[model samples]
Target: MKKLYSILTTALFCMLFWIIFVLQDINLLKLDSQEVITGIIVSLIVAYFTHRSFIKEDPFWMLNFKRLGSLIAFIPIYAYELYKANWDVAKRALSPKLNINPGIVKIETEVESEYGLAMLANCITLTPGTITMDIVEEEGKNYMYIHWIDVAATEIKEASNTIKGAFEPWVRRIFK
Candidate 1:
């Protein structure tokens, strides 16, 4: 039963990604019979290889409406953060007296699953003026090393709040 759920869940997720990334023609999502056939076959194959890590505990977790809503809600929040980061970076770059303190800072995360951790790292990387260098596990806690253009706070609590911003919470809601 669990194995079937894993395969099914993985395959469904792969199919969703395929439609969003591969089959879509920009704003309009058009799909032919050939594309549908191809998507299913490829999704099944990918799911077969990746099912073990695709889901951790509950296979139906992603199907929850609230979690799915969080995933959808993250887009605008991410965009807002991107917009702010870009402007901040631009301002710092154009300033005559450079207000830059570039360094790597460690921040702890509550996201337990590996996929959630990856998602958080990727979100941090996508935003301007910050890049995730590494994620480490110490004493049952997840910590991420992020290279920020400006080092706001060195302490773990402050740094996590500063660098991660809105990324971690939404990711936790969606994935964990």
Candidate 2:
């Protein structure tokens, strides 16, 4: 049963990719008989090869609609943050005095899973002003060492809120 579910999930994702990229149809229309047959064949083959790898310790956890919804919502928020970070970095670069309080600060994160922690680290690193320097686990709690161009607050809670407050909860939802 688990293998069947894994295969189905893999095939479904592959078919969706085929429809979007090859068919170029968001509505999934305008697909001819040959294209449909080809997509099904390709998806099935890919699923057969990849199904075992897809089913981890938790088979259906990642298939939750709520997590998908959170991911979709996070996209726009990330874009806005990216835009603001770019402007901030540009201003700092072009400034006359170049006032920058550069230091690495340790901030605690509620995210426990390695995947979730990695995602958070990548998101912070991708942003312009802050870079995730290291991730440490102490007493089963995860902490991120972040290199900030300007240190606004030295307190850990304040630093976490300032840097990852916007996306941390969303990431927890998506990866929990």
lDDT of 1 by residue, 110-175 (tens): 999888999999999988899999999999999999999999899999999998889888998998
How would you encode candidate 2's per-residue C-alpha lDDT over 10-100 as one tens digit per residue? 8888898887686554445666788789889999899989987755545676779999899999999999989999999999999998979
After best superposition, candidate 2 residue 1: deviation in angstroms?
1.6
Alpha-carbon lDDT, every model:
0.90, 0.87
Pairs in clash, predicted candidate 1: none
Q: What C-alpha lDDT, on a 0 to 100 scale, does residue 11 get in candidate 1?
A: 97
List of clashing residue pairs for candidate 2:
none
After superposing candidate 2 on the true structure, give the runs of residues whose Cα lies further than 4 Å from its correct spot. 24-35, 48-58
Name the lDDT of candidate 2.
0.87
lDDT leader: 1
What are the root-mean-square deviations of the candidates from the true structure over C-alphas? Answer: 2.8, 3.1
